[model samples]
Target: MRTRPAGDEEGAGSSTPPAPPVSLLRSGRALLEHIGPYRWRIVLGGLLGLAGAAAAVGQPLAARALIQDLGRHDAVAGALTLLSGLVLLGAVLKALSQYVLAHAAESVVLNARSRLTTRLIRLKVRELERTEPGDLLSRVTSDTTLLRQVTTQSVVSAVTGVLTLIGVVVMMATLDPVLLWTTLAVVVLVGAVISGVLPRISRATAHAQAAVGAMGALLERTLGAIRTVKASGAEERETARVRRAAEDAWHRGVQAAKWQAVMGTAAGLSVQLSFLSVLGVGGARVASGAIEVSTLVAFLLFLFYLMEPVSQLIQAATQFHIGAAAVARLREVELLETDDAPPRPTRTRRRSPAGRPATVVFDKVVFRYRPELPDVHRGVDFEAPGGMTALVGPSGTGKSTVFALLERFYEPTSGRVLVDGRDILTLPLPELRASIGYIEQDAPALSGTLRDNLLLAAPEATEEDVHDVLVRTRLDAFVHALPAGLDTPVGHRGTRLSGGERQRVAIARALLRKPRLLLLDEATSQLDATNELALRDVVVEVARETTVLVIAHRLSTVAMADRIVVMDSGRVRATGTHEELLARDALYRKLAATQLLLPTPEGFTKAEASQG
Candidate 1:
């Protein structure tokens, strides 16, 4: 089996992986890629905003002319008209820009959700085993929502804000160079303080998002097993656990909010301080006859106007930091591996054409779930040829692992598994899986109508074929009794159905596929004796035309197998008919006798027999 190096074994108890380094440049690039398709819309919005800023910029100049005309007792009608027009024009342009940006932002979110959802569904099974489903769901919903604001509005706002700030600075310089220098000094000092605060906002937001994901995962876990929790009387404990996660999220969110508030305060303070410094200096200059009254008024107006761009810049920065944290999470999901399998074929059929059943062979196969874990299968070797072959072993002896390997839910660490004289690894995944029908140990049913679950594997199966399989699995009567028949809804995980009913549904679904190889992992474990016997006859009938491999513990099921493979500690201990193995294999005999499949020997006590 595969093994991990000794150096990598340290700190195996850590509950979470180390956080990745946060890179603003990398995050920005990823955001740009997501925004690529909507670039033109964002550009149009930015242009409109620039136009609005231009109109606002001209208003102060018009007001200065109007004031000069009034002082000289000249006609001010023309100047007043110009000022009014600029105000209305600026308002209209800004409104149009905001609408366009909002639309583009929503589109960005939709595209992101679509791409992330596709990646999530196609992720390798091994990755899903290690990741929490609830956390993945949060990434798809909450995380992608962050991209809507940051991708378009924030990007365009930053560009327009910077250009507007520069234009306003130039206008202020024209009024008085000394006043402009005073304003610049104050802005520079506050800008430095805000720079230190942005990184903290990013870090805090990252922590808050992670806490939210953890909370979601915890909530999903509790709700998924609410019945079990209620049975165990652990409602209080689970509630406390989820509440702690929520509190952690709240604390981290508060930290992010604290830093954002600091940045906003600094941006506002810089503009206010610049205003005070310019007003005092310009009033003294006017007193010294260094500048006109109209000049001073216009300069003050420009200083006030500086606040708009300053606020925009700060808002853009804050949104970028928050969105970057989300981008990082989304990127981590994109980096996960996916199965390299062909797309599933669209055709459907009731059964494979009549032919010799497919044979299976496990040639010294070795396997494990992970590198750090011990091998679950140690050189397991077995063969099943065109008939019903049952695998019997004590619990945890790698019985279920064999079925998982056959389905390629996992890959063997070593050795080869062959189907019909060809290595399974050489076959396309879709083709390999399409040829086999498997019933899991739990026989899970999805949340949907009974018809939906029955048609999941064979969506195009005809009604006649469905009715035939349902009768064979002894589910026709039960399904008919339901108020809606096949249209009846099964609650989440088939909670609406009894355990026996779910198992029979699973069996019927598999039978509808008409697979060349059928794998039953405790297929009838939940069935009543009468139903079990009936399904056993169905399996015997199906095995005549196709291969059937089963992992069973009940003695009646094993006694009917054409061949039996007895396993012990991941190795095949014996393989033969049930009677031959019972006479030779100690483990098989013990298992058989435990179920009272054999008569009691002369010296065996009742207690020993019960404990066997």
Candidate 2:
């Protein structure tokens, strides 16, 4: 086992500094870009909303005609019919516009989520390792939801509200300039208060969103290791930690709600104050005979109707502030580094052939997980020439780091890693990875059917290929015992299977890929004696077809390797056959003695040594 250095698990307790706050202008531009695809639909919705406003405006004029008709004792049926038509038309247009905008909103959210997920999958390993999985998950799910309203409905609402407000003001001015001026005074005062409140809403919403992400991270952390928590009797402790996170989220959410409530109240107050001032001044003007009773009634009707545009404008601004926070969080994810290399063209199953065993070389390699951490590989030099090579060492000897470097999961600090005599950095990532299969220590299995886990690496593999690999890994009997055989659900992380079964399944999956190089880290650790012996034989057989690089502590497995490399303190100390190393290397001799693979001084015999 390789010792994990400090900062290796930084994401668990600490994270990179929070990204700088995104500018309002940049966030606004991002929102607009999200809306770009649905611009035509949004335009149609806005046009319909404007038409609805036009109909609403005509209702007041119709009411004024009706009032004049009533005062003159003239027939009023035509005036009543016109007012009813305007009301019905306005309602129908508003409904149609709302439906169009709602549909567009859902589409926008889908696209945003798809793009974010795509970017996340391609992000560099370093970025992923240093970020909480749950936090990234929240951005894909919750953050993208905010784009729905801001991208379509809020944008159209803002535009229609401004246009309608202008139209209402002009008509009000025509009715009575004195009353219009009086109404403007109240609106202007309220508008200034609302402007101040909007920024605070943005800031509050950003904090609230961050707290929600933290809560999600805590929940994910607890659930991911529920078995360990239960076994250790720490259920209550973990629950309390998650509960505290949830409480923090709740507090931040309330803060945002308070600011939003203030904005809402200010918007309503602006309309109410304008109505009172207009009524008082319009009444005085009517008394002076400057305007007719009908004109005063129509102007008052417009003042009441003015609330629609005012509320729309305020609502648009509020939604934008809320969405800007989500945009900033989303932008932070976008800024994380991603693999820039284009994937190599995939070969068709029929056209592709089996890969030749690859030669691997680590030339003066040096590596550290982070610049602040101590070096894991200190100018280590080694070579494996297409055969079974076993790396045996004490803990913290940089054994696992070699596989990581080979997979290009992390770059070497100041040296070269070559596969088939070519620098790995110069190869396309997909192409390089496709030729290598790595079975990690834990041997994790995804949540799916047995067949799904088996074909994960080789999706193009045939049913015959699956069965052949299963037999090689001695898993055919286990699959036959399963209720659904290959179709059985594996459960989360293959909890349904035993530890040894998961390891064999992982090996079978990797073998199906027909990789040129197979790297195994403690592949036999979970197995019983019977299964371990079986797997050892399978590995030896596979080594004849491809390069097999294994890290093992068990002398039983190491003894079978064609060559054994003794490693210590991040450097290769010796390379030779097991018998040759036992005769020459001090570390190899002690290690074999510990496993009882070699005879001890006090009790040793040829028969006992041969059996061992």
Candidate lDDT scores, in order, read: 0.86, 0.85
TM-score of each: 0.92, 0.94
**Candidate 2 Cα lDDT to native:** 0.85
Q: How close to the true structure is residue 355 of candidate 1, measured as C-alpha lDDT?
A: 60
The digit string of per-residue lDDT tens for model 2 on 180-211 reads: 88888898899899999998989888888887
Residue lDDT tens for model 1, 1-612 = 112222333212212333355788889999999999999999999999999999999999999999999999999999999999999999999999999998999999999999999888888777776777778998999889999879654798899999999999999888889999998899889988988998998898888788778778778888988999999998998888888878877887898999989998898899889888988998899999999989999998998888788888888988999899999999999999876646866664445547668899999999888888778899999999888999988776788888888888788999999999888888888888878989987889999999999999888888998999999999989989999999999999999999999999999999888889999998999999999999999999999998999988788888888999888788888999977875666666677776526665445556654553
Error of 1 at 183 (Å): 1.9
Backbone clashes in model 1: 0
Which pairs, if any, clash in model 1?
A: none
Please identify model 2 stretches exceeding 4 Å from their true place: 1-5, 8-20, 340-347, 350-354, 595-612
Candidate 1: list runs displaced more than 4 Å: 1-19, 341-356, 595-612
Looking at model 2, which ten-residue stretch has the lowest summed lDDT?
10-19
